[model samples]
Target: MKKLQFLSSLGFFLFGFLLFSNLKAQNSTSSSLYFPPLGEETWEKMPVNQTGWNQGKLGEFLAWMENTNTRALLILKDGKIVVEEYRGNRLTGLGPMNEGSIWYWASAGKTLTATLMGMAEEEKLLKRKDRTEKYLGKGWTSMSPKQEKAIRLIHHLTMTTGLNDQGVDLDDTDPSSLTFLAKPGTRWSYHNASYTLLKNVLESASGQSFETYFKEKIGDPIGMGGFWQRTGKNHVFYSNARSMARFGLLLLAQGQWDGNQIVTSDYIREMTSSSQGLNPSYGFLTWLNGKSSFKLPAIQREFEGPIVPSAPKDMYQAMGRNGQFLMVIPSENLVIVRMGAHSDTSLIPYRLIRDMWDRFAPVIE
Candidate 1:
């Protein structure tokens, strides 16, 4: 009798211990994603040593950034700022370019639109699979009705609209500029015209301006301060460095801000994960890392291997012209934002973040 009792006790104890360990891990993961309170400048901070980042190496990284005309670089780990560096203002056109200065997000704003589109989907304003003409009318594109019908809303989000990018003004909104390249979903091109058309589709579908909808859906909920300003043929978002980090945090949490789920987790997953087959290294307007292959802007070549090998495999980003970058790594509970003038000839921000990770891994290890 005592032996049986002992066996039963051992089984119960093992189950209890396993359950406790599981719960602890869950809590730890949750705790790693920090959400700052709304309407406040206050945000939690984690010490540099806690991240296992060597201070000496970190200083070297900052020196490199300063040498390269980096305006601001902020790194968030477990939802708190671990490293924040600000340098000279080489680009006077974009505000003061200081800590509180507002700078344009450029193409990085596309990620914001993607998030808004997901919210619109949640609200039943529109569907990703819905035909573009469903919202923009049949004649919105110069393509024939048959070709237009095949081009769904998702093509815009995925940059697979089969739109001709040859000799087309990227920011031009005229219907004639949207020339046909191939059938929808057959070809993938980083055509800004297709992406810009999304703004018109969102406005038409939601019965609100893109800015209004974004302010209501994402900006208000997350305590983010930014506005869409008319810049040539595009609407550019300008905000301080902290606001960009806030948005990155929201993405890192999979569209959850604090306790409120701003965008559905499912939509967030689809937005961050691969959206189409053409480019496995891209999500809904976001750049993904650790993919088997990737395609660059204005290039049809598919390079084999992760985009940024030095960064975390799970890292994805919103990159913009002039080196605006917002990198979100879910596995590490990290959100990194860089806003500044372009330091290199290439538009890709991979080198910047790769250099960051190379120096950062030692500290956090």
Candidate 2:
């Protein structure tokens, strides 16, 4: 908690202020404002009583996971439920959480987009090696003439898309931004804009909207029935806690369902494991905890920005605003999902993922 309070003290404004500054000038320039839709769904509250999942000190911490809003946590290890819990104002502090409770995926949905991309590859719809210009020609052209050249889908997937945060870095055309932070296969950055654009490329190549394609390829198979937010909505999906777990199970099982393979296990490994080495803390669109190619020194800078050493070293997560998270730890054979408003004050779901991992790790082994 000392470390967390310290992290809370870090400069979150620099990240927010920097991001907000760029949003204005780029507003008209963007294709749409629907990137992450905020439409409210009448949340379906399940009975909060979970038999196997009431963890120890972790339970008290989990009660905080949903601190002021709806929340649920599920743990599966060695194919058994270790912990499951949900608390929301809707529950009125009674009843128990069940298998059905829809929660927003937020940016965590980006992993689904990338998963669809891998499935498309298996079907040969598009190739990662294809130049970004080939599929997103008109849009990529409009992005910038400089960005049009030599940018590949693989580069976009790994977040080395020759672009920088328009909000933080005023100069998108700056020399360093123009150049890949590291070569295509060497680095990683959390580029929301670039990853969202991949949605278009997939649609263009597959003749299917992003959500429909995912349902056809993945949801139906895993029995998750997860539904996507409309086009331009980058990270909004609704599904039960079990649905979230199924997605995690698909990943935990390395992209298979019902003894049938949906995505190539080889590709799943690439997506979950480090695809690029620049930031050892990040995977394709997911977050990870691991060694870095170079010391990022977040603690040295006392940085609490997105990339830092506050999470599990072996953990990879699909995280979003308002405390929506799906954390998968392969070594523990674990899948943990936490969804809710952790705090109105904290923006990154810092405590949900960061603190939960620390508490969960000890009991896991």
Candidate 3:
């Protein structure tokens, strides 16, 4: 009887030890990612040979970027910089573009706004299902009160507000510029006006100016040196290339920076995953690569297959009007940022992403 009792105790101890070991392993793996210090120019880097990438193809890949008008390109592996390069003129009389030069994110800033919305939701300051009129008040849009009531805050995030997008400048946010089209959530259009109104929604819900809230909640904490600029009627975000990479790293880490959960992981999952069925390739203001079909800006029909065929199925992007791209691939533990002048006239530039991956895959894979 004594022997049996001793054996049982030993068994329990062994089981507990194994469990503890497993948990520790997981924590170590998750914590392996490095984050650059806040308010500093220093960032850790991983050696190219250690990344196991084909070094021979790297030069050609970078040459492709320069030839394609890429001003800045950064690639991070496990939160460590693998490759960082800046080329081309600044065009702002600020000399040649470099690591410290500022560039417009254009529509890529939509992802930043979406993350802010998620943070606000986690704090109970706002809910995705809340009506836009709740924050913007009545008569904010030209639609009738009853019609506008059907449009929820989620509709704006998903770009399904059914606002009229038939014009040269779909980003105009004025009440007169916003006119009713189809019923809310019944159509999927990349209407910028609906997205731009989200700024007001965030402001009204948070009881703080958009700039102040963003800086406090995201920018300062992550060491992002950027600011929102008012260009005509639109509010655009501008930041240096490394600042953009830092945001991508935050996304790659599932909204966590170092040990702090800046934005809840739950909301990050929802924001990156497919939000609506009409366009499976679009998340909440973010573009997804792997989906059955995708819809483009100003286009009525859906295109078959993934938006970027060469990109990993799990990869999602924060793309802008010009060649700006913030791509996050969780499976590969990679975050790539590209900021440049217009590579093409297309709004989302799905083809540009696809072609870039075509040149990049040989080097990385």
Candidate 4:
């Protein structure tokens, strides 16, 4: 009787150990994100069933995007393409919006400038604390020398330069257009003219055209191909959707590509997290999703709650006019990119993203 009891006790212990080990393996596999090889078209895929994603629901969501003028929507889970949809045409002309078609990133390109500024700082080409006048010269603005000097390069990155956005030339890069409204760091206003001046600041500091500096520092190294176009006083970035995805992936990996550290980890934290107090939902030209409150473009009013409630609390995004978006969710190991014609104003894309999350939540853990 004693021998039989010992055999049964050993059997129970073995079963419990195997069950715990299997559960651990599944959690580890599901929770981690993947990184693909640079310069390769190949990427791995996580099967829908394995991901706990409902196939029928995903089909319904794609169908809804088709009716909403969505040109292209790509969602990456663990660095692999899980949902890819392309529709509509290029906005400037009638052409199929495929993987090869390039589209403007509009204001979303601000984050690119922010990244370049960080990289330049990493290389000791410029410092964020330096005054704008240091690069653009003493008389570069209409403000008194003292007031102008108060506006530093970091102010440009944080949207706290206190430059007037009510001027006739919002996109103007001319010194006169950069009129003073409030003292630097006293207010938070999304002034395009103030942001566009970073082009000149970077050029003067680095002694390189924006294109050359970007190509050598980021584009060529990561296999991303995009060009900046002069539109009025603003330089807008244009690239295919995949190129945008590659940039998002770079950020998702904390500015690292494969094993190479493209940008310092400290800069990545500063750029993606909050850079100022006035608008808690903004980083260094990047829009943070989860915060206690947020300010919007062309408006001084502050709203309560995260920018996008449905998105993960840690998500940070680059959004543009006409609905271009590159969203990175670190907690979920997810990167989402959307490029299309304008749909709504007043940043209602927050609602759009909320709906997207509602559909994706059931699929993801």
Q: Candidate 4 lDDT, tens digit per residue, 333-358? A: 78889888756754326666666667
Between candidates 3 and 4, name the one with more favorable TM-score. Answer: 3
Tell me the whole-model lDDT of each prediction, alpha carbons only. 0.84, 0.62, 0.89, 0.82
lDDT of 1 by residue, 15-97 (tens): 99998996576445655578888989898899887877678877777776776667888999888988877776534564445
lDDT of 1 at 195: 88
Segments in model 3 whose C-alpha atoms lie over 4 Å from true places:
1-29
Best by TM-score: 3
TM-score of 1: 0.89
Clashing residue pair totals per candidate (backbone < 3 A): 6, 12, 0, 0
Compared with the true structure, the alpha-carbon lDDT of candidate 4 equals: 0.82
lDDT of 2 by residue, 1-365 (tens): 99987777666867788777755433322221111111332222223243234346555655555544657777665334556676653223345555565666777787877888899988999999898777766444334554456678887777666454444432132234333333344434555566777777888899988778887898777666667765343446777676787788678767755456778877877887766646555567766665453222112122333442545566678877776778776655567777666563332465556566555544433
Error of 1 at 22 (Å): 11
Ranking by TM-score: 3, 1, 4, 2
Residue lDDT tens for model 3, 77-144:
99999999988778495688888999999899999999999999989999999999999999988888
